[model samples]
Target: MQSKNQLVELPLFAEKQVTLVLKREDLLHPFISGNKYRKLKYNLLEANNSGHGTILTFGGAFSNHIEATSFAAKEKGFKSIGIIRGEELVDSWHKNTTLLKAHEDGMKFKFVSRDDYRRKEDSDFLADLTKEFGEFYLVPEGGTNTLAIKGCEEIITEDDKQFNFICSSVGTGGTVSGLINSSFPHQEVLGFSSLKGDFLKKDIDKLTNNIRWNLISDYHFGGYAKISQELIHFINEFKKYTNIPLDPIYTGKMMFGLFDMVRRDTFAKGTKVLAIHTGGLQGIAGMNSVLKKKKLPLLDI
Candidate 1:
């Protein structure tokens, strides 16, 4: 399903004379929304065509991938198994909103320690999972695989050709890689990573040889799944003004970076920028719970 692109209006836009539009990929589904839908679409078909009866993937407490994969697997008539990263969550997984939603959608969980989770790519670990789950199609953590990139490529269409720049929040690099591959020659693709470091550039390079893309390494705001009071305030204020809700992990950081760049005149005057709102809104409730426990201000969505 193609989502409508809404133009974002801000005082800064007029003052800077730059046009900003938000590609509402978040509206793709109430549950399996945004880049998650794009990433999983073809992967699901591939799994079914390959005669797989179960889908196995990896994630953490509030991983959007795990939740989206669960619903997608159920809708496709395939069973799903989520290899959760934290072993301590095994007892309380049902209490966590994200995991609970996945469970409600018929996902089974295999909780592992953080140390053990790091070995997910090892042959022996994967072999053990295959033996236990009985021959399942494996989706890598964060849902970035060859098939996933193929699906994400469809996010940008001919209609998006008018824009000079295409921006998105980079996680596993699949969505941004797809954007890079599909971008027009005149359009530059900028990916704002939601994690710390410049390592994602190498992974995206492995996927596509395109030289039209650049990775922005300074906007992570810590690392994956890490949030701050400032980010929470920005997200809330942004929603209040634009009616567009941004999750703390990805889109929020992306928009923050994009706007900051605009203030610094990163783009020339009259430049049209299209920012992809890859959805992770489902995890907001789970994140709010964490904030509540820590006595931090909750997201005002």
Candidate 2:
């Protein structure tokens, strides 16, 4: 039941004399949407082909990847294990809607300290996990893998070629890599990083030969999972104006960056811009809780 999400033009962009359309990839699924869906599409198939009954992945407290993977595995009839970072969450993790929803979806969580979580890619660590959780298909954190990039390659279609710039929010670089691979030579792919770092450039370069893409490293307000009142206000205002609910973690930041670029006249007057709305809307409630704790404006989802 996968349908094409609409590409709606933003009136704000019209004011700037620029054509900006949001590819509503968020409409793909209530749970699994946008890049999460793209990333997991082939990974799950590979897991099933490998004869594994369970899928084990890693993520943090409010990871959209964890939430999406949990629901996706449930929908696809695969048992899921989320190796969650921050061992302290073991006691009252239910306070977070993301983890609670995953738990409800039958995703067992293995809580570990932040330091221990860093060893996720180590062979010995993975071997120990296989012994502890039994033989399972391991998906890297954020669901970025070779299969993931393959799935993401499908995000663009023949219809998207009209746009000169293809933009997406980058997490683990899989989505941008896919976009880069599929982009036409006449088009440029721009990735706005949600995390603060230049580290993703090498990771993205490893996946594609297309030099038509560039990473925008300055948009991350603070760092990963870190938010400010300015970002919260922008998310709220954006929802009110466009009725497009953007998750603060990914799409919100991406949109904020896109709007900033538009305001600065980053692109030519007649340029067409397509911003991919990579879904993470499910995490809004959890984010709202944190915002409420900090006495900040919550996303008007």
Candidate 3:
């Protein structure tokens, strides 16, 4: 589905002489929202077509992918398995809102050690999972694959071609790659990296040959899932002003970076920018729990 592009009336845009429109992909669904919905679209169809009765995927404690996959699988009549990254979560998974929600959606969890989780794509590791789970369709960590990219490509439509720049949060790179593949040659795609590294550039390059893209490594706020009072403050204030909630993991960071660029006068005076709000808001409750423990300010729900 094509998400609405809402113009942001922030004073910063007027001051910078740049037009900023946010693509409300977050409104795509309450559970399977944003890029997650797009990423899983074709993957689920392929799994059903192949006659798989179960879907298995990988994620960390508060991964949006895990929660989205669980809901999507349940909706499609497929049992779901989430190979969680930390074995410690085995005992405390219920304390995590994301995991608990996934469990409530009928997803079974297999908490493994971080070391073991790293081998998720290894043939031997996958073979062992297949042996244990009895046959299941494997969706890669972050749900980024060929079919997922195909689904993400549909996020951009003819209506979006007017923007000179398209911005999105970079996770496993599938969403950004799809944006790059589908964007017009005249438009530049800027991927704000949620993870701290230039490695995503290489991974994204492998997925698409489009050169009209640049990976912005700043604004990760320490790394994936990591946030600070400053970022939380920005998120809350942005919501207060725009009524658009951004998750700390992905969309929040992307919007933060995009706004920073505007302040720095990165875009030309008349340049139009479209930022993708890839939903990960389900993780806010989980993040708020951590913030509470840290004695930090909580994000406004």
Work out the TM-score per prediction.
Answer: 0.98, 0.96, 0.99
Model 3: per-residue Cα lDDT over 1-301, one tens digit each:
6788899999999999999999999999989999999999999999999999999999999999999999999999999999999988878899888999999999999999999999998999999998998999999999999999999999999999899999999999999999999999899999999998789999999999999999999899888889998999999999999998999999999998988999998998999999998999999999999999999999999
Error of 2 at 72 (Å): 1.3
lDDT of each: 0.94, 0.88, 0.94
| Top lDDT hit | 3
Q: lDDT tens string, model 2, 141-260?
A: 999989999988898888888899999989999999999999887999999998987999999999999999889977898888788888988888877766788888888888889889
Provide the lowest-lDDT 10-residue window in model 3: 87-96
Residue 252 in model 1: lDDT: 94
Better of 2 and 3 by lDDT: 3
The TM-score measured for candidate 1 stands at 0.98
The local lDDT score (0 to 100) that residue 205 gets in candidate 1 is: 96
RMSD of 2: 1.4
What does each candidate score in C-alpha RMSD? 0.8, 1.4, 0.7
Model 3 stretches with alpha carbons more than 4 Å out: none
